[model samples]
Target: MAIPPHAQHDTHATTRRGGWPTRRISVTALLCALSFIMTFVEIPIFPPAPWLEYDPSGIVAFVAALAFGPGTGAIVVVLPWVLKTLFSFNVWGHLMAIVANLALILPAALVARRVRGTRGLVVGMVVGGLVSLVASILCNLVVTPLYTAVGIADVIAMIVPILLPFNLIKIILNCVVTGLVQRPLSQALSA
Candidate 1:
């Protein structure tokens, strides 16, 4: 018996403009909105750097990358930064955030794509977290001095004591949350 067109898989399925599958675009947009909303719910995990609060927006973006691929994940990461920057006008902070998040999401997504399975994801998270930690520190050295009263020296001083720990904690939190939810969310979204 032949499968109906609606029920059959189309290997040559038509994509929307920009080559994104329509479903991927829809999922990415929904995840972007969630990530944007999550930006408001920040938790101060590090006392010395309360200003460097943690938000789960990255988790959503990371999951989007894991599910849909890096491009969708990147859009999910940037949309929140754009929206937050519009409201706060903190261009430097938002730019740093984009760098940090993309650092995490891109590597994780790429590694996960290459490796496959839970092992792949675990390795991806570790690699992504370390990359994010390094990127945040480097961005802080350059960008923090531009916006805040802190000089480059001051930012460097804060790196080992404050920034390092804060970013480590933030990356771990995002990775853990993403790992926990990724499979379930992927299953649900695919369904």
Candidate 2:
């Protein structure tokens, strides 16, 4: 049988190239650059731990994952850290940032994938926040000692008084900012 005239062209041809969508690749790259730039704009929410600054870069990654997919979100999260590593000697800090971001974005993206609408995103953020909180604490216990004079006990001592609230605030801020922008940004991108 002969193919119909309308069916002769591959519908995906314009959207994809070399096993991936060209538009998606471009969009991911743009988001990565934005994320990297946002890293510079950090705010110290917790005075007790001024180093635990909050940056909106994670919002960019979370939105990317929510709009595109978890893989894209993961790339968006890590690329900024990789770029920072080139300029800064803080390898452990970069690694912890990557871990915390992936912990936040991955669960949300996965949950959003399984459940549709805002409800899914919200549920995922909550779960992601909890996961990130624990991950940050554990990471501090391991990585903080490597870079700072703080031992495991010192890190543990800081967790409740410093780390816990800091992570919670950061997670909430990222989630709220992402929630505000995600739908509008997704619509704009699709348009």
Candidate 3:
């Protein structure tokens, strides 16, 4: 690569996709670890729905997504939930969760990447939250009804009421925490 004679710094640069970058892995691992830790500390917000709960899994996913990209974020988001679903063996819930994670993380990461400070995190969180909110509504109003035709409707109904607010909190908290942590972590990891 030829350097610009007058360049103050190396403007032409590319990320090291080699060896998965130890630094990037550390950040991803930290967030992944945090995500696991949050699972046990679930805060149940019981009211509109008995199953309403606050889960920080999204935080880690969002952070990873921001640090890495939507692809990483999607996997990070899916892994734990997939683990949970596997253990529970609830196919319906697992499917919904997979869909939810896929919907939320990309928008959050995209927004997060656009800025470089607290504002970025806020934007990511907002975008993730809105995306999740809209997705939940669509799933609730459309997908679930169709899925219920077989034998899932009752279960879907039980989940719908909880879906909106649960996801709202999930995305917001995920975005905020990931946004906050990812910045410093990103700098540290990337450096």
Top lDDT hit: 2
| TM per prediction | 0.90, 0.90, 0.68
Prediction RMSDs, each to the true structure: 3.6, 3.4, 5.5
Write out the backbone clash pairs for model 3: none
lDDT of candidate 2 at residue 108, scale 0 to 100: 90
**lDDT tens readout by residue for model 2, 70-123:** 998999999998998998878898899899999999999999989899889899
- Between prediction 2 and prediction 3, the one with superior TM-score is 2
- For model 3, the superposed segments whose C-alpha errors exceed 4 Å read 1-19, 22-30, 142-163
Of candidate 3, the 10-residue stretch with the lowest lDDT total is: 8-17
User: Candidate 1: which pairs clash?
Assistant: none
Writing each residue's lDDT as its tens digit, candidate 3 over 119-170 gives 7667766776777777766666555665456335564665646665666666
Q: Against the unseen true structure, what C-alpha lDDT does each candidate score?
A: 0.86, 0.87, 0.65
Worst 10 residues of 1 by lDDT: 9-18
